[model samples]
Target: MSLDSATVRRIAALARIRVEDDELPRVQAEINGILGWIEQLQAVNTEGVEPMSGGSPVGQAQARLRPDAVTDGDRAEQVLANAPDRMGAWFGVPKVVE
Candidate 1:
């Protein structure tokens, strides 16, 4: 899993990044260093280790949820409360990437 200059160039092309000829060696060494760290991590034994989410251990604490009591009131007013621009019932956001 070592990285070479050719592999670094290919990666830059695939990521749509422009790299100078002199920068290739530095990029290759950096990527190879990252790969070496990953290889070291892969050599560790995790036979009894379990996966956890968001820094919390499994089954350590329960998440709380609001009560499911249904009440419909001012649905339109609630939706338009913080809209920067609005036209009656609709929110007006600026056109994007046109």
Candidate 2:
């Protein structure tokens, strides 16, 4: 498909790109070049090629995560001790609403 001056102007307007009167031909030429390249790419024959995620044929298996183990980190008391204001085991803050 060939990109014409009108199509280029419409695309520029839609993309919010302001092309001056003199620059319209330049923009149109650039769009035609890009579309020409795309037309060349469309002629390639890829009959039985499976689409791979990372562009590589050898798909690497995802690494397994370690099973969740019940271990106590136990830093609650230490964190609470450094608070500016604490009531028993909870943080104390000034009332935000009247």
Candidate 3:
């Protein structure tokens, strides 16, 4: 979808980006170019392409996983010793929400 100047300004505001009045036109053109490239990508034929979940493809060499074991257990006392506020076996922080 092509974006207008007003739409580009709205996008910048939504993203909390401060775009100067003079830079609006340049930003608008750049965003429009990106959208055009996306449109071109959407026009490609990929009816039989399978969706990939990660960077590596399926049936490829997988990363070796280490055995799950607790290497730093029984250190709760030491960990909580320097805590400003301790709640039983956990560190306590001020409640931010009601």
Candidate 4:
């Protein structure tokens, strides 16, 4: 599949890219080449291929299971003592932006 100049400009606009008039041909050709590669990839036959999780072969997986626990260690008061500028219950910092 080939991409035209208008489609390339639309794509550039949708992607928030600035494409000048003279660069449209190069951009359109590159997009057409990418589409052609995708078309070529679609022609490949994968009849009996099993989908693996995240491209890792299922046979080589060794995941360590851990317990899911939600417990606050009650260290909030202890940690807030080290703040140089502490408001009532929050840490204050100098403004870094104009």
Candidate 5:
């Protein structure tokens, strides 16, 4: 799928990018190179490969889960100490609704 200069200009306009007339050829060539790599990737065969869902290997055990415990509680004064405008333990903001 080769891209012409007109198609490249149209793509730039659609993406809200301002590409100069002289830069169109370079941009078009770069896009064509990316498309060529995608074409090469598509040509490879992977009939029964399982898709990876996370960084860990497929057969490895998952990471140990941390115990759910509250380490900090009842520190309202400390939490609200740096507020320019606060209302009863909460930061206050200007209302914008009508």
Candidate 6:
């Protein structure tokens, strides 16, 4: 599907983007280019292709996990003690905004 001027404006509004009146044409062209590329990708045949995680193909190699070890041992109190305001072992900060 091709991106039109109105659709581009609606997309920008939904994304909370503020595009100048003069820049709307450029934004529309960019969105159209992206949509055209996506449409081209949809035309490809992937009947037998398996979805892959990461750069490697599916079932190509197995991943390894590190052995369980003692990394940090009971440092909660030591960490909490450094906070500016501690409330029974928790950091306290003022409300960020309304």
Candidate that would win on TM-score: 6
TM-score of 4: 0.61
For model 3, the stretches where C-alpha displacement exceeds 4 angstroms are 58-64, 72-98
Clash number by candidate, in order: 0, 0, 0, 0, 0, 0
For lDDT, the strongest prediction is 3
Compose the digit string of candidate 2's lDDT tens values, residues 4-95.
Answer: 78888899999999999899988888888888899898888878877677655657675589889987868779989899999887899999
Q: What residue pairs clash in candidate 3, if any at all?
A: none
> What are the Cα lDDT values of the candidates?
0.88, 0.85, 0.92, 0.87, 0.90, 0.88
TM-score of predicted structure 6? 0.63
Candidate 1's error at 59, in angstroms?
Answer: 3.6
Cα lDDT of model 3 overall? Answer: 0.92
Q: Which is the better candidate, 2 or 6, if ranked by lDDT?
A: 6
**lDDT comparison, 3 vs 4, better candidate:** 3
Q: In candidate 5, which residue pairs clash? A: none
TM-score, one value per model: 0.61, 0.58, 0.62, 0.61, 0.60, 0.63
Which ten-residue region of model 2 has the weakest summed lDDT? 54-63
Q: How well is each residue in 4-89 modelled by candidate 1, as lDDT tens digits?
A: 78889999999998989988888888889999999999999989998787788887786788898888755988889899999898
RMSD of each: 5.0, 7.7, 7.6, 4.8, 6.2, 6.5
Tens-digit lDDT track of model 6 for 30-75: 9889989999999999999999879788888778878889786688
Candidate 2 global TM-score: 0.58
lDDT of 3 at 19: 96
